[model samples]
Each structure stands twice: as C-alpha cells, then as structure tokens.
Target: MSQGPAPRVLSDEALSELLGGQQFGTLATNKRSGHPHLTTMLYKWDPEARVLRFSTTADRIKVKQLRRDPRAALHVSGGDVWSFAVAEGEAEVSEVTTVPGDSTGQELLAMVRGSVDPADEDAFLQQLVDERRVVIRLKVQRLYGTALDVNG
Candidate 1:
C-alpha cells in the first residue's frame, strides 16, 4: 500500500492569487456565543493594502456581529476543489450610508465599480443609501492555505 500525497502549502503569492482571482468567498464572523457565523459574500481584495472590502446592509446580523467582535476570516476557493485560501483579520464596519456621495458611499462605489461600472452613478449611490448599506473593511493580518497535488 502506498501513502497518498500530502496537500502542498500554498505560497504567499499563490494564496494572494487565489484570493484576488475570485470575488466570492465565505466570510466568517464571531457570534456572541463564540460560534462562527458564516455568510457567502462578494468582496474586493486589495493585495497592496491587505484589506478586504464588503458591502452589506447595516441591519444585517453579520454587521452587528462584526461591530461587537471585529475578528473575521474570509475563505476563497482557488478555482478548484483541491486548492483554497483563508484571510484572517479584524473588520471595521463603516457607518451606514445616510447621504449619497458620502465617504462610506464612496467606498461602496469603488467596490461596486470594480465589478461593474454603474451607468447612473447617482442612482447607484442613492440606492446604497436607500438600502441602508455599509462597507466592511477587513485589514488582513494573516493568510494561509494549501493545495493538493493530485496529479503528482
């Protein structure tokens, strides 16, 4: 009998690539009971700043959880079942967008603009306010993951 190949530890570059290559990931926040609250979210990863940004409603439970406990982690798939990465950090939830074109709104604008350029920028900004949205900035402190060498 032969032992199977162990999962290969992903390098810093590989981990960053995996995180930046994908826009959707599982965001985990700590609940009051010390349990992990998981949410599937669309996020923007800034490799240079080591920050992950997410747009969410202010009334959402995740926002409440993050406000109470800033610790959070995001898990992103490496475009395959055998590879993945996790970014752990502290989250700072921005104030709900009350006025369009405000700082929080602007941050949301940048995150949305990364995916699609809204034709009506004003409408987009206003919509964010209407939805009571806020931006969550996760300052990534550590990144670690692994990839399995299946073919090897």
Candidate 2:
C-alpha cells in the first residue's frame, strides 16, 4: 500500500475555526456492550466555553448511552481539500429549561432564529419546545486534527 503524506497538525485557532464552521459531525457513543454507536448530528460550538453542544430528545439512545458512559468522541471534517478533526471529550446531558412563565422558549429561539423566518419564529420555537430537547455538552479533553495543509 502506498503511504500518504504525513498529516500536518492543526493549531488551536485552526481547530476552533473548523469546529465553529462545521455544522455537522458524527458523535460516537458507547453502547452497553462497549461497542460504538455512531450518530450523525448537528452541533454548535462554544469557543468561549470551550465545549461542543448538540440538541436531541431526552429519550434518544445516544442520551441513554451518554448517561451511562460520559466518554464520547466527535469527528468533524470539512474542506474540499480534505481536512478533518477528532475531539475526544466527556459529555454531560441536561434537560433544557426555559424561564418559568416564559412561553417563548428562549433557548430554542436562539438556536433557530437565524434560519427560521422572523415571522415564524414563535411557531418554530413552540415546535422545538414541544420536542423537549436536551442539550448534550461535550467538555473537550483533547482536540487534535490534521489537514493536507494547514495554510490552505
């Protein structure tokens, strides 16, 4: 087999940029049998918090797996040039709570306002609230990525 070129290490800034721009990735969670269960998901990166978060319903298998085993990995890849990154982290799942008596679903609103039409914001928020989504926060323990060329 022909060997490929050595992968160049990505810097913290580069990784953060790639992560923030990546809207989707595969989340790897451990099933009870210790096998990997992979789920393609949409994620939001919080650079300031240094964590990655994704929304999913409370009853999802990934949530159950995470609750049982907090250890997880998120593999994100981007760039037509073939760049990829893997973040190994511990996860914490929490039920999303809105302010009491605030029927607007603040968290959901913030997440969808950019994509949903302004006039439909309320309806979208309501739909999200009805889903009872839980936010899974991944506390990155180690982040490493490689690209064909970092400067590219």
Candidate 3:
C-alpha cells in the first residue's frame, strides 16, 4: 500500500496566525514519575517575543511539574481540518502579582482575557487575579506544523 503524501509544512506567517486565534491547545509536561501530563490550555502567542504564554494556578499539578522541570510542548490543532502545530520549549512560571502589578504579567493576562472573553473581560480578569493565577512563559526552542488536507 502506498503511504500518503508527505505532510505539508506551514510557513512562519501561517503558524503565527493560527496561534493568534482563541482556540485552546493541549500543553504537555512531565510529571514527577516521568509520565506525560497534559492539559487543555488557553495560550497567547507572541511571535515578536518568540514565546507562548499560558495561565494556571499555583496549586495546579502542572505548575509544580513545570517548576521542577521546565521542559514542555504545546500543540494546537484545527478542529475542522488535519492542520496542527507543535511548540517545544522551556517554561518559566511567575505568579501574577497584583500588588506591584508586573508589567509583563499584566500584558499577558490582557492578551489571554481579550482573546477568551472580551465581552466580560472585567469579571474574567478579576477571577484570574483572585485565584492567584500564575503565568507560564514558554521560550520556544523549536516550532513545526502542518496545514494539510486530509482527503487529498
């Protein structure tokens, strides 16, 4: 049997556009036992900064895992098609400090809130702040993806 055509590769511009949307992605991290721990995440892709930002609370297991091991992978896919992207990188965790209000943290939160719920942004922002949420900054070492037709 013939193996299908080679997977189509996505351009940098295309990958940037795809990640800029409000779609959720699956973030993969390593657990203490060396098993893969995955969770659905809302991410902010900053092409200029070459980093991906995601939020989680301090009590979350992923946060602890990442604190112990910075390695992570974030995968975003198109629901209607076979297109997908993978970002492999190291993570840095920072608690959102509302007292002093970290500039980078504020900006990241705004980007995430704006994308996820612009209509009710105030409530969402407050909830994030109240929850003691932390931001995960992924410094991307590699990026690869495909935007290919499945039926072709």
TM-scores of the candidates are 0.95, 0.83, 0.79
- By lDDT rank, best first, the candidates go 1, 2, 3
Put down candidate 3 lDDT per residue, 1-152, tens digits, no spaces: 98876778988777777777645899999998899999999888888888998877878899989999999999998555578888899999986645323563466557655366656655666676677778889998888899766684
By TM-score, who's the top model here?
1
Q: What are the RMSD figures for all models against the true structure?
A: 1.4, 3.3, 3.2
- Candidate 3 lDDT at 41 equals 94
- Candidate lDDT values, in order: 0.93, 0.80, 0.79
Worst ten in a row by lDDT for model 2: 96-105
Ranking by TM-score: 1, 2, 3
Candidate 2 Cα misplacement greater than 4 A, ranges: 1-4, 96-105, 150-152
> Candidate 3's C-alpha lDDT?
0.79
Candidate 1 all-Cα RMSD: 1.4
**Candidate 3: misplaced stretches above 4 Å?**
1-3, 96-105, 113-126, 150-152
